[model samples]
Target: MPVVFRFFSVFPLWLLHVMGAAMGWVVFAVSPVYRKRLVENARRAGYRFGEVRAAVGHAGRMVAELPRLWLGAPLPSRMTGEACVEQAYAAGRGIVFLTPHQGCFELSAQVAARRWSAARGPITVLYRPARQAWLASVMETARNRPGMLAVPTTLSGVRQMIKALRRGEAVGLLPDQVPPDGQGVWSPFFGRDAYTMTLAVRLAQQTGAAVVLARCERLPWGRGFVTHFEPLPVPLDERLESAVLQINQAMEHLIRQCPQQYLWGYARYKQPRAEAAAGVTE
Candidate 1:
């Protein structure tokens, strides 16, 4: 199975795109709940239904590009977009990238990794290990690339990421990931209590890393993406809930800029993790 995934990863980028697009459409057709969620999120973001449809279509483009993301697509060289981490890196202040499930997230990482690789600074991206054992092998093989380190959402992984930042390297994470028991706090996102990961805030506070919101916006047609960077105010306090709210607010600002790319299907407001309480039912 890992071999099959590797083979697919090596396939021509165009073929991978096609398969991703097909998979996305299948989801849109068969999953009414997903579409509904997307609609609700769009509304929360102040986008009308017509705009949400357009956003969903743009998400389809992101889906098409997903395969390339896992397959090590070469980073864009002429990154005409303004990804502003260079300034922070120059100051010897490590960067903590707070990204939402919006736009071409993979592209954002790929572009950052490529751009900063030459500077001898690496980027660590936080990720959750796949729940399915088989998918774990597939994901690990696909994500570990030069200049980019995949940090799992575990205590050990958190330590690894902090160590990297202390060395003046950038560490990234999707603050939206639902953390396990004792690892998250319920915070208001889009007017609802969503279980939010505290890792992003904690990392920034611990390392005094420059907190920034980064994203990849898809251009019309096959023109490619524009990754942007902006400084985000870090609430560097031991109090986690306040920090989580700030992170969400920052990400929400970015998502508003490109509503179409924001992923709406995620159960952002799901109840807090009950990992310990719901033990081994299956």
Candidate 2:
């Protein structure tokens, strides 16, 4: 797998995207279950199939571009809405970056880490270890970049994020990803009840970290990506449920910005595994 990834890593970005789009359509055509979920999720969000059909290809691009992003040299990229990030940094408090499964989410953290790690500190990101041993080993090597730290989705990992935040560093999370049974609360997402992780809200509330919304937009023909940053639109409620709902609403807003790039096929509403159902930490 590593050898395959390394071989693909040398390919031109444009070619990878081209292959990826074709792969996306192939998957969409072959898998009825995947196609159904993609359409259903988009429709539930009030988007027509025609409106978000490009997401089918974008999802493939997301995977295809990883080799270049992770193993190859840095690609062309930039950040917009710098003021939001600047303002958050000026606060001298920690930062909690919340991004959904949209565009090149993998690159967003790399961009942040490269741009600000020296000035602030390494951005600690929460990630679930891949179930496959080979894939997990590859991911560990790929994600351990210079300015970022990847922690597992465990209690100890959560503690690492907290420590980073308290030290005035940054931590990134996909708040829309369903958490383990005991780690999340049921909340409304896009007018539907989805189990949402409360860690993003809790981190901010506990350590006074600034909550920044981030989205990485994939440019056409693999021109590279642009990560946009903004402060959370609304104040978080004092109540946990209300705050989780607010976070979900914020994610909805981000996804709406470029619905075509969002991964509408993800099993966002699926029940979490039962293994972590006991003694879950906040």
Candidate 3:
């Protein structure tokens, strides 16, 4: 699998996207379960098939671009609304970067870290290891790059994030991700009760970190990406549960901006997993 990814990494970005779009459609056609969930999730969000049909190809592009993102040359990236990040940094408190499963999310962290990690500190991101051992190994190798640190979704990892924040460093997480039992609370997302991670809120509240919402949008025809950074619509509430809901609402707003790039196929409504003895199942 790594070899295959490396081979694809050398392919032109446009060709990769084309291949990815085809891959997306093939999976959509062959896998009934994936197609069903994709359709249902889109419908639940009040989006019609016509409105979100492009998402199928977008998902494929996400996978196709990973090789280039992980092992190949860095794609050209530009940031807009960067002043928000600057302001956060100026606060001299940590930054809680909240990104949903939208656009080239992988690029979001890389962009921020490349630009700010040296001046501030490393950006520690919450990562859920793959179940497959081979994939897990590959993920670990790929994500542990300069200026970035990937921590597992465990209590220890949570502690590490908090520590980073208290030191005025940055930590990033996907608030839209469903956390394990005891790690998240059921909150309204897109008008449905989806289990949402409270870690982002907790980190901000505990350390007084500036909460920022950012997305790296994949440009057309593999041109590159436009990473946008901005502050949350409203400051996180002191109340933890309320803060979680606020982040969820912010996530909805972000996804709405580019529904076609959102991961409509993700099983976002699945029941939360029971916490293991280690208290971290991801």
Candidate 4:
């Protein structure tokens, strides 16, 4: 399958984007809920229906650009880390890069570890491992590129992240992702309460690391992704929930900046479990 994707990567960008539009529609057909939610969420956020449609189309293009990101563009060649990393190092602590589920998230990390040429410590990304063994294998190989490490969404992985921070390395996590019960807190996202991962805030407090936002913006014609950085709005307080909400707002701010690239198909608002549903953090 990877070989097949490699072959497809050689195709023209315009053609690939067209194919991706069709592919996205196919997926949309199977998941009406996602399609409806995408529209509804955008509208609720004050995005026009026509604007949403255009953004959705750009999303298809972003999907097609995925293969290009991995096989065609090298991290060092594509991504640029700004004062973000330098600021992180000045703290003399580990860095926690909070990336949204927008535009080539995988590229942002690879570029930092392999390209930017910074004296960054260990770069750890927190991700939910694929359930299917075969598909999981492909994902592992594609993301586990040079100079980057994968931390599974487990207690073991959590420990590894803590260790990395203590060593003054950098760790990354997608706070927008839904976490298992007991691992998340209900926070406001797009004006709706979402079960957001609190680990990002906890890590910041535990390690005294500076929290920063990193996003990969897709360039036109599949040329490459431009990496942008922002400081998180959260304070360095010990309370997890307050800090978590601050980060969630930052993510929403970024989403508004590029509404078209944000992943609206995601089930952002769902019934919570006994822990999260009851607003229990500990």
Candidate 5:
């Protein structure tokens, strides 16, 4: 599998994206579960199929582009709203970068880590480890490059992020990623109750880190990505529930900017596991 990825990594990104789009459509047509979830999730967000259909191909591109991003040569990227990050860093407080499941999310942290972490401090990114041993090993090596540190979605991982933030370093997380029951709270996402991680809000509140909404938009035909970083629309409240809702609202705004590239097929509304659910309060 690594050899195959390496082989594909050498291909032109545009070609990879084109091939990925075809693969995406094939899956959408053949898998009822995927299709249903994609459509339902989009609909819940008040988007018609016509508006989000492009997301199917974008999701595939997300997968296909990983090899080039992880193991292949570096690709060119530009940033907008970069001043937001600079200002935050200059303040001497840590930064909390909250990116939704939109566009080239993987690229966002890499870009920031390279651009800022060296002068500022390292960015600890939250990610769930792959179940397969081979994949997990590959990911650990790939993610722990220069200024970036990838931590698993475990108790210790959360502690690591908090420690980073307290030390005036950055931390990145997908606030929209459903956390294991006790780790998240039921919050309104797209007018539906989705399990939302409170870590982003908690980190900021505890350490006074500047909260920013960021994403990397995949330009057409794989030209490259344009990363955007902006401040949260509203300040996070002291209350946990209010803070989580604010985080969700910020995520909703970001996703709206690039509905086409958002991962609409995620099981956003799935019920929490019974064991874990018992620990999470409604």
Candidate 6:
């Protein structure tokens, strides 16, 4: 698998995207469950099938582009609304970047780390390890770069993120990803009850970090990605439930911007697994 990843890492971005789109269609055509879930999720979010149909191909492109993103030289990327980030940094508080499962989320973190880590500090990101050992190993190697620290979804990992934020550094996470049973709260996502992670809200409230919403839009023909950073639409409520709902609403706003790139096939409404005792610190 590693060898295959390295081999694909050398492919041109455009070609990879083409292959990925085809792969995405193939999966959609073959998997009845996946097709149903994808369409259902998008429709529930008030998007017509036509509006989000491109997401099928984008999903495949996401997988295909990982090798290049993880191993190849940095791709061409630019930032928009960077002033929001600058302002956050100017405040001298830490930063908590809340990105949804839209666009090239992996690339968004890479861009943040490259653009800000030297001046402020590394961006610590929370990640769940892959079940496959080989993939997990590759993921760790790819994510632990110079300006980014990838921490697992474990107690100690949470502590690491807190420490970094307390130092006025940045940390990133996907607020849309479902957390373990005990770690998340039931919140309305896209007009449906979905389990939402509260970590983002807790981190910001706990550390007084600036909560920023970020998204990376994949440019056409593999021209690379453009990452946009913006401040939250409204102040986070002090209460956890309200804050979690606010985070979900904020993610919906970001996803609406480029519904085509959002991962609609993800099982966002599924029940979460039981929390692992060893994974929680406090």
Ranking by lDDT: 6, 2, 3, 5, 4, 1
The order of the candidates by TM-score, greatest first, is 6, 2, 3, 5, 4, 1
Question: Would you estimate the TM-scores of all the predictions?
Answer: 0.86, 0.97, 0.96, 0.87, 0.95, 0.98
lDDT of 3 at 228: 87
| Candidate 6 RMSD computed on C-alpha atoms after optimal superposition onto the true structure | 1.3
- Which ranges in model 5 have alpha carbons more than 4 Å from their true place? 274-282
**Per model, how many backbone clashes are there?**
1, 0, 0, 0, 0, 0
Cα distance off (Å), candidate 6, residue 75 = 0.9
What lDDT tens digits, residue by residue, belong to model 6 across residues 1-282?
999999999999999999999999999999999999999999999888898999999999999999999999898999999898899889898999999998899999999999999999899998999999999999999999999999999988999998998899999999999898888889999999999888888889888899999999999899999999999988899999999999999999999999999999999999999976323233
For model 2, the superposed segments whose C-alpha errors exceed 4 Å read 277-282
- What lDDT tens digits, residue by residue, belong to model 1 across residues 10-38? 55545554565567667877899987887
**Which lDDT tens digits does candidate 3 get at residues 1-282?**
878878888888889999999999999999999999999999999999899999999999999999999888888899999998899889788999989999999999999999999999999998999999878888888888999999998778888888898889999998888787777888999899998887778788878889999988999898999998889988888887898999999998899999999999999999988875223222
Report the lDDT tens digits of candidate 2 across residue range 1-282: 888999999999999999999999999999999999999999999999999999999989988988888899897899998788888888898999999999999899999999999999999998999999988998888888999999998878888998899899999999999888777899999888998888888889988889999999999998898999999887788899999999999999999999999999999999876656322244
Write down the lDDT of every candidate, Cα atoms only: 0.72, 0.91, 0.89, 0.73, 0.87, 0.93
TM-score of 3: 0.96
Model 4 C-alpha lDDT per residue in residues 110-177, reported as the tens digit of each score: 77777432466558887777788855776676666667788677677788888888888888888888
State residue 46's C-alpha deviation in candidate 2, in Å.
1.0
Error of 2 at 80 (Å): 0.6
Report the Cα lDDT for residue 95, model 5.
Answer: 94
Query: Residues 134-237, candidate 5, lDDT per residue (tens digit)?
Result: 77887887788889999987667878888898888999998888777676789999999998877787789888999989989999987999999999987889
Candidate 4 local accuracy as lDDT? 0.73
- Winner of 1 and 2 under TM-score: 2
